[model samples]
Target: MNSSLLLSLAITGGLVLAAIVAYNTWTLRRNEPKKAQPPDPSAPSAPSAFGAAGMDPLLDPILRQEPSLDGDLAGSAGASPLEGLDRGQDPHDHAIDPSDALRMPAPAHMAERRPGLDPLIDVIATLTMEGVVSGDAALAAFPPTRRAGSKPFAIEGLNDATLTWETPAPGQRYRSFQAGVQLANRMGALNEIEFSEFVMKTQAFADAINAAPDFPDMLQEVARARELDQFAGDHDAQLLFVLRARQAAWSPGYLLQNAARVGFVAGSMPGRLVLPASTPGMPPVLTLGYDTQAALADDPEQSAIRDISLSLDVPQVHRSEQAFARLRDVGAALAQAMDGVLCDQNGQPLPAMAMDPIAADLELLYDQLDARDLSAGSVLARRLFS
Candidate 1:
């Protein structure tokens, strides 16, 4: 039992214990799954940021696109640039992509164009003059001067400074005579009957003024114009949903910060947020704005958000139903999350029942538009609707 012998024994026992612990640890680690390493910062990320077909806004391309007008404007006929829907194609064959619908179209100049005058103009002129007047007789008429609240129509060479279509002085003699139908008025397109009356009046004036006596069938022209006007009426709607916090006033900073998480970006207008379209230059399908004066307060750091609103521009968007549904869901979610009231533009609360009629109307309009080869939110539709 010497002290040196005892010390050696203790050291050996300690070494044996350490070896056992190390071996157990190695075995446990080998059997267990390895912990995942942190992702490589420089490596490309999975495509989770965007949805299938690049629908998500987060993955929107940096090279933003405006609605393409090339094919429509250039008259590249045959297959339609709009996939799934053509003049003769089944309208319900495809779903309008949400992302695509949200994108704003180029300004009218950027898209397909029709001549200012209707095709029937030349025909009317030729028949009236019996080939004496050039087929380009519409050119003789001053282009309809569009005055706010005034129904302007092309007057073929009627140069009387005092004459408005509303009151063409009867028996007034002029070097040139009024001809053709009044195409459109300030309110909407003229129906067939209106055009017929216009034709009669113009013809009478032609006779009184010793102008050409021939008349052209304006029924077809009137029908086409009526359809165009009807389309415009159906699509010119603007629907709005409002949210007002039930608790404390909203923090603008927090609201703006979280809004981006849900896909809204700073809008062009101050105190507004916009859901931009997939096409870069097209107008946004959805816009949200604040009602509180704080929104426009000079202070850039103002955090008060007393009221918020969500709006859908019907004509500008492709699928009204989808847009409406998405808008409703998003508005409801935000309202619930923030303890707010969900209401319509009139401040009346909206229940599930309220949306049903709206949805039905949307479907009906969509069907009508489709039947006419004017799909909602398409370039041609947009132009005609506008």
Candidate 2:
């Protein structure tokens, strides 16, 4: 054999072996079971933040951030930097955060469980928008609108509510503020479900505006009462509460005053709720009591007692009507306070030039409030049948 030809034959044999090996490898890969690719891992991870993973409408945004049911309800609202109701405090104890609104519903039974506010506020705000909160005076402004039929005096703040506890004894008068809900003449105390729901939801709202703390108008001055003192009969008390829910973030005077008078004000936070000074022996005379209970349409009960009447100094109605006037004017201020606040529902500012519209709306409010034809239901107030 020639040496060159032999060398070529060896090389050819090597090539044939390599080809066989490659062919076998290809056959194995084709016959091997095909892999079933897993579904995208991201698809199953959303619901904890929004709706249940597969059911969320807001899931897209919720999945993008950590979600807390409580915090979400709150932050879902307005420009109130104050909205984190449970931030520093334990949600179970109902230990109110001084930084928020005093509107927690009755105390909770167990810390482990919680209710939601969305339903309650939705109902109330809708009712209010429908003129329930506006009262009859508001209704007269648009005569076409009528009362929401008389239901039981629910929501304690409505008419037909009562505080019918028998008097304690001499030198003492017993008063109570029990809220009710009414759809017509058939009114009754608020049910547990409704009341708690309102509180839970309202807390979200209060939290929204908790910190901004709208102050009284620079023009209006309310002589806030000093703390309750057992031995302090001559201690001074304020004349009136300016509507500050719109601007002043201070605790609502109605809540504070009621709390202080009883010495055991019931509420969510201790710091925010101050009870009145009343000891067993040195009791402060229940000189005045504001009836927050609802009464029959014909039954007259005064909603607020004139502080002037209670005050040692000028014990006569201020007669200025300015306080009442504020009801109409303050609506604009309240609307303005919400200026930068997005719709919370839509994350956008209110209707165009929102501030100007608020003022104009308030002006229209004054006309409606003072309207003679609708005055009967204007303030939704009643004077107790003395």
Count of clashing residue pairs in every prediction: 7, 50
Compared with the true structure, the alpha-carbon lDDT of candidate 1 equals: 0.49
Q: Give the least accurate 10-residue stretch of model 2, judged by summed lDDT.
A: 308-317
Error of 1 at 224 (Å): 5.2
- Candidate 1 scores a C-alpha RMSD against the true structure in Å of 18.2
lDDT of 1 by residue, 242-345 (tens): 78667556656556644454566665445666665656555566677764465565652344565687766554567633777777777776777666787754
Tell me the lDDT of model 1 at 87.
18
Candidate 2 local lDDT, 1-386, one digit each (tens): 69999999999999999999999998866443222233365766423211223422221333222211101010121232112122112211121112212222332121111111111111232121211222233222221212222222222112322333221123322221122222111121123343344334333332332211122221111111111111011111112111122222221233232223222222222222111112222111111212223111132222221211011011011212232233223323323432212231223333434434433432333233223111111112110000
**lDDT to native, each model:** 0.49, 0.24
